[model samples]
Target chain A: MPNNGMGTLLKTPTGISGLDEITNGGFPKGRPVLICGSAGCGKTLFAAQFLVKGITAYDEPGVFMSFEESPSDLTQNFESLGFDFEKLKAEKKLRIDHVRIERSEIEETGEYDLEGIFIRLNYAIDSIGAKRVVLDTIESIFSGMENMTLLRSEIRRLFTWLKEKGVTAIITGERGESSLTRQGLEEYVSDCVILLDFRVIEQIATRRLRIVKYRGSTHGTNEYPFLIDESGISVLPVTSLKLDYKSSTEIISTGLPALDKSFSTGGVYRASSILITGNAGTSKTILAAHFAMSSCKRKESTLFFSFEESPDQLVRNMATIGIDFEQAIQEKMLLIQASRPSLQGLELHLMVLNKLLEELKPRTVIIDPISSLITIGNTNEVRAMLVRLMDTLKKKQVNALFTSLTYDGQSEYNNSTVDAVSSLADTWIDLKNEERNYERVRSLLIVKSRGMAHSNNRHDFIITGKGIQFTTSNKK
Target chain B: MKENTTDVVIIEDKLELTLYISGMSQKSMEAIRNIKWLCDKHLKDAFELEIIDIYKNPKLALEQHIVFSPSLLKKLPLPKRTLVGTLSDTEKVLKSLGITTEK
Candidate 1:
């Protein structure tokens, strides 16, 4: 009865954690999707997360077909992710069926299809009135079944039946050598093809996801890295193609008095994305929070995306330094959105930002240590995502501040990534921290600014209980 | 670098291939200078050469399948060849394209 459509179409939400945001509401709401990935790349985890999350979060009962893991093995593994499969099972909101497809155990002497797995899945779905389903690595039949011809047709039939059932299903495949999936399952699943990749770069393992194809609906075309932690799987929806946004011309203070004076216009323009690149412990988040407090004082909304610390701890720690975010939160002027960069892919983090911006309509957005995001993706991907993010912020006219931590303070001191957005940016601020003689000191520099004149001198500053008050001036 | 006489010239769309180079890095600039000199001296006008700096027009590189710098894409002719480094080697260049130098 609710009208949430552009025309004669409606959208269904996937209760899967961190997915609806990326798909802008989840797989076109009932279209079958192919989630193919390599072995031990968490295909089972990905499928389970979808089912468990659907049942618990959206009241959408789901059926999970496990071709490999026993139902109990899955229950125990996901239990660590805070997913109570047993509880959901008892609630009758969920169902799990392990289709024991041991080629040696079953003798297919005559012609046959995978109607057995279909019947079992249908029974589970019908019993629960399920709206979501998952076929976990069903392509393992490549190794399990000897008759490729019969199995292929059976797999095709299974997908078609899933369509007839009209539930949004996720069919996961093993990243076998022959194809992107062992059995080349992509040729069959038509709605959306999603590839999950687990790669090791510099000895650090990372998981990434990409939507290879999504028919009818427009989707982001970039590899989005995700992570599996205690909270479950977090997929980054990094690229947003929407350019519709508004930019504010008004300039706002960064809370540091002398720093404000150094700006040719006396302050940073609203909706501008400012990058403050520096070495570790350069007070990046602290400085961003200080400016946020200033904005909140002016009765403007601000959103802080902290990659390093939790929002509560950040607020509490800032309190020790005499910056109280509690009052701002109570006043509805400040909201800190904190998450581990490793918790999800870059896009996932960006989607959260998009959500917060839409909900809070903040005047400013702060990302503490954008550099950590670099670890999750390669150079090109990181640069491309930042450009999109910055472009989105500019369109929104939200004053955006991003902190990038670099190891070498003097060298490679500029923002680096997949693409160069410095040309697209309105202003850039660099924060530097080093031991000057025997005393450790912090300084800020205005690297580049478009449209308005800016002071070029680097000024020394320090953190004392009161806040980030500058020790240098540019007004003279 | 040469506004007077186009740094890149394609004889026609016959030159179906084009190598787009971008960036102000010493490597890219030096490679471009050499590609222009060597390509001009050796290949002459028989083959079309197009050189582009990505920094100036980064969007153009992605449009034409260019991932690295100082790349020479022999276009306007069928079957394109891309070289990441210098565009020297006279004998192979002519023989591959079935060209005979008058000199």
Candidate 2:
């Protein structure tokens, strides 16, 4: 209803590009979220993002209480990620207080409570009018204290206090054997839970995040890929069915009129997803740009999502191929966004795409290499994401085109991204780099084109200063 | 200011839970170490040490009712004597139960 406007935006904003949508307008405002992960799994970073994002985006002052590192250490370490902790502290909008739990300094007298911790937290929160609080690795207290009965009671008290204060707190704990936290902290914060995992698959490190639990609101269960960069934590929760949506119905050409004539119903259908599969250095990106250029020429806006290269690099390289991306960009007909796939999780990547699509409302959307995204997620997750994405594209009637890298060496490793989106796409095209004697030639083939009779033969094509063309065509 | 004494007999019974105390909080870790040191030094010989975890078993502590903490008791020792605070003044710890540190 957009009821309350900006003032009523209790949204946490997540500080991450696309996570807010899946979170249904950020995490449950002031409730606690249990962030459990093994050592060196980016637990502290995730907590830092919460505090940083809260201060910058929501204007909701925050306090970060660390039980591990000192405030100076945190500031220096996180400075690389563009988080000026010092600046935030100086502005009095953010406060970071490190509670060093030195076992030797603590003196157990009689009937003592955690008043010291409570006092420090309160001071920090109150100093900056903080609506958000973070207790990083507070479980160290269990080691510092001998009495579990008192410690357990105090932990519960701390949570109750945070709730009463109406601050959205993030309590990070080391992962336990069976329970969510090593200290069984989940036994406390039962409502919101987020689990971050950094696992190595086939010698490649990939970081994945998933909302394990969210109370009173719907959330995407899929594990989205997140990136921890100089900009802090960027979570890619997959796109949700937003209330605001738009559609298109005008079919765009493939930049080549002859190829467009091959469609039975007159070229590619509007809002239909086209899958173009090829190997590295096989003109996949160039082809995608050409298609976007065609859309731009039609005076319809187009968005190019490039993963293999940078936006500037893509523009420069495409200009060499006579694509004229500069003119398209100047005309506001094309937007080229490029970034490394490893920067964030696949879901985060999809979220970025979702935001870009929403803002730009491009008539034609192009993802240069879908294979990179496929590598970040499991088979089922990738399939589900692609189905949603294609559905969104079709509903918007924005003709979607994706380029996928395929391994032709083994049949088993062929077109994993294609295999993911093929069932959902309205058209599928395969680009092959085949060996003919000593000369390696590039060939294009169409596997299937729904609702149309497409050429089912492998035709060789070349990328010159002008454009791409084929000499032979075979069909029945 | 209360003087109470019991029979001078060593309760020869295996404790339901054999709790151990090793590290002393004197110069070691924290309250856990101090508590451990107190338990190790005093509490007589009736409460035999089983498994001493200055780290692991600290969280799984239960059944014996260790509320005040650093306190020790013989669940099987007849007339279970419950004690709190660091086990200093060894003689006082022994005489409180009408027994000597010697087995």
Candidate 3:
């Protein structure tokens, strides 16, 4: 396990994709972690994924003591995410114990402790030599039992026994209105507490996860946005990399020869971020498409994220400008991921992009009109997300180009999206449509290019059938 | 099977009960004492009780779907009833078994 120079607290390294990074390694090893959340907030899924990942990735056997769902239901639910619990159980690598307590069937007679649960868990753990254990929503026992004092004491004992047994455990509970957990289970499991929250801001559902507390271990305190998809729960720990990403001096063509001549390096830095801001229909997507095509022409893979247009529409529309994205896509050199900005939250979009970047390993990534993402979140959130996105792209040494649509009469710097991205970009290009002699004349200006003496002249550019053609005249 | 038949014969014409416990915890010990006292005072030798530790015989506990410790299961009665607790409340225990005791 990799410790982030913060004391030598032994960590467990929960093999869930991005969770370990956020936890600074994982849950404190051999200690119980309380995961509390409201209903439908993915608490159970997070716990299940933790155990499943433990078994598959770490080769550590796990025991899942579920008080809410049955064994079959759990298996079926996780099966859709590609976790075959049945097969894991058959191999003796996993144990599923469903402790059902019906209020009607169970009649409490006198002073009793919940030793039965302990026995069952002990038996299951011993049988498989499990190193990971999950008691899904153990707070259900509170509703089932009438004696609060005995239940509370037994719960405390259960945590101590788990620590003595030396297994990493996840005990889930329902979130309380004022307290961390409904039954105040947080008081018992004092080592670590994680809160999962699901909220709808502007009618868009966003799931966020926060590490409320982790004793003796340093962890990221920010609320990380998580997503539950086909692969399971993925908590996107934004930009775990430091700012020491190696910048490349290698120059790459922007596909427009005359426009490329405006930069001192003759082209953009290989891994630097480029921002192109212009009003709508100023061929922002066209410019982005040309960059993608240029990368594909060099045999380097390119990923084009089109938020406004479908892949087919983008392909057909770009074909009119003599840029053939379809050929590049068919050649497997270019991957176009077109999605509606309203389909999911901005964090999910970033997560999807992160996943694609890992799987595709593209050399260049282009997002057409990043301004559209402004609708999905507040200004600050969008800016933070973009900063993390840029950090990730830079760390991977992938050349990133983002196009932003500035509203009419608003300067490129005045646009919030452009304002946020320009500060992080290595090169900024401002495009505008100027009405000249009853004709709509398009012009491009190099706003700023770091580490390069770029031409500041506003040159007229024409979008013809052969893509963008820049005039040599420096006149506006 | 032979032992089970012999045990049933001994429990004949009496309230046959099995108490499932997990090890010798205080609660389990208390349940044992309470159930014995209840049987002695209420049934007066008319009830037979067997205490089984689930930790020692976990398979039996799972086979019977007995998930709670300190649970009293009445086996010989026509309608079976399971009351889970330390068995400290003699009145509640008897009432759960559908037995009437002298006030």
Candidate 4:
């Protein structure tokens, strides 16, 4: 346990990746926090991670009192998440007490309190000197008892006893129809409360976590999407809302000398986001390939996310335009990730991108035709996801290039999907194909470039064996 | 699991019962008094009663899954039954324990 300062409250680190960032530090120490959710939303897993992380990372012993699952079942379930319950128990670092209650086997005659539970918990905690506790779905006790008044009172007392004992505890509950929990367990453990929601929108399932209440602390109030993989739970915090990312003065070439000359600075700023919007045959992907090739030429690792084309397909197609991506792929300076937009939920895609970014430590990233991702989520959700993606890239000081496909007749200024990234982009390039003399002529325009003087005149260009070449009249 | 060997009077019997209490609290005393009276009046010497104070042995509480204090467990009957709380209702307690009273 550690405090941010002298006057700040003590906090326990959860040790789950990305979770502590949103929680500021972690849950309040030496207090009971309620984690309520519907069936199969990962409440049990969250509590288990809290205790297990406490033991392995903080050297604190823990007690797990399960009211639903048996001890064997709990051990087996947590084993998949890399937690060895038996080993921890053998070392006297963890104690699991399974409280089995069957309503049909009991007949309530007169009056009684839950002294048995208190004594058992006390004995277990004292035996191990546990500092962390998890009562997984303690509300299940309500199912085995006929007296609601007595159970509620006993539960209130149990929380008080836990606090008095000076152990940080997590009490999980089932989601209620009206209140936060079915039995209103939130009414008892009120120090801190978190709600997990599992929702399927448009046939794509997303798990979200929200902090309903956290007394005496400042925290992220937005609903953060989380993922449960083999490693454990990792919450994706909606990144810095303030535009405070560091700026870089270094410029990076676009691999096309003609295109570089179009900007006043001769090249785009390093770590800046660039957007390329064009119609079907306007060569948006080709332009993005040029950016990736330039990054690879500079010996900086580049990550390309291809939504519509596979890696081999992209390489082969780019080769036809005199852009040799095969050499860069072989040199290991470029990594291309190809996946369909419908392959998984939006959050999973973001997680995969994050994992790759962390592992590769790439200096530049490209998403070819980001418009395909719009099909997977609603307008607002897709916008939010892109905003988070851009913010993450900006924070890492990684240059990002995104290509968007505009419909033939849809104005680039009017398309909602393109507008989403265009407003946030530091540089915007619009490409168009028009019929002139029964021949399709492709022209490029620099719509807007922030903090730079760029050519606003349309320059007709053509895809040649040497890549994109500006027509003679437009060249300086 | 059968850890109450201290206060057991006899092993072989038609009715084998274990009463789990917490430090002779008021509820535990009432439950002990009521169960003793019912067993003596109904079964006479055919029953064996074992009283366990969980305060002395708290591990047994978890082993037996005793959530509520003053729990009465009938072990010798074909179908075991658990009754929680103080056994103040004599008729209901006897009837639930499979002992019939003449009308």
Highest lDDT model number: 4
lDDT of each: 0.70, 0.70, 0.86, 0.89
- Candidate 2 B-chain TM-score: 0.44
lDDT of candidate 2 over A139-219, digit per residue (tens): 887885666777888788889888888898999999888877888888888778888888876455667788888877667
Query: Which CAPRI tier for candidate 3?
Result: medium
Measured by DockQ, the strongest candidate is 4
For A1-476, candidate 3 gives per-residue lDDT tens digits of 66757667888887777888888888899999999999999988999988988999889999999999999999999889999999999999999988877566568887777777777888889999999999998988888577898888989999999999999999999999899898899999989999999999999999999999998877888898888999988888765657898989899999887777788778899999999989988878888888898899999999999899999998999999899988999999999999999898898899889989999999999998799999989998899899999999998999999999998878776889988999999988888887989998998888999998889888888988999988656422
Judge candidate 2 at residue A113 and give its lDDT.
44
The true-versus-predicted C-alpha distance at residue B87 of model 2, in Å, is 14
Better of 1 and 2 by lDDT: 2
Better lDDT candidate (2, 3): 3
Check candidate 2 and list the clashing pairs.
A81-A230, A225-A345, A226-A345, A236-A347, A236-A348, A247-A396, A271-A397, B25-B33, B25-B34
How do these models rank on lDDT, best leading?
4, 3, 2, 1
Residue ranges of candidate 2 with Cα displaced over 4 Å: A1-13, A239-245, A264-266, A269-272, A276-378, A381-399, A403-417, A429-476, B1-103
| Per-residue lDDT over A376-421 for candidate 1, one digit per residue giving the tens place of the 0 to 100 score | 8778877877877887777777888877776763453354631254
* Model 4 C-alpha lDDT per residue in residues A1-476, reported as the tens digit of each score: 54655557889887777777787788888999999999999999999998999999999999999989998999999898899999999999999999888777788888888998999899999999999999988888888567899889989999999999999999999999999999998888778999999999889999999999998888899998899988788898876345898999998898788888889999999999999999887888888999999999999999999999999999998898888899998999999999999999988999999999999999999998799999999888889889999999998999999999899778998887787999999999998888889998889899988888888789988888878888845443
Q: Using TM-score, rank the candidates from best to worst.
A: 3, 4, 2, 1
Best of the two (1, 4) by lDDT:
4
- Model 3: residues with Cα > 4 Å off, grouped in runs: A436-439, A473-476, B1-13, B44-46, B65-68
Which DockQ-derived CAPRI band holds candidate 4?
medium
Share of native interface contacts present in candidate 4: 0.90
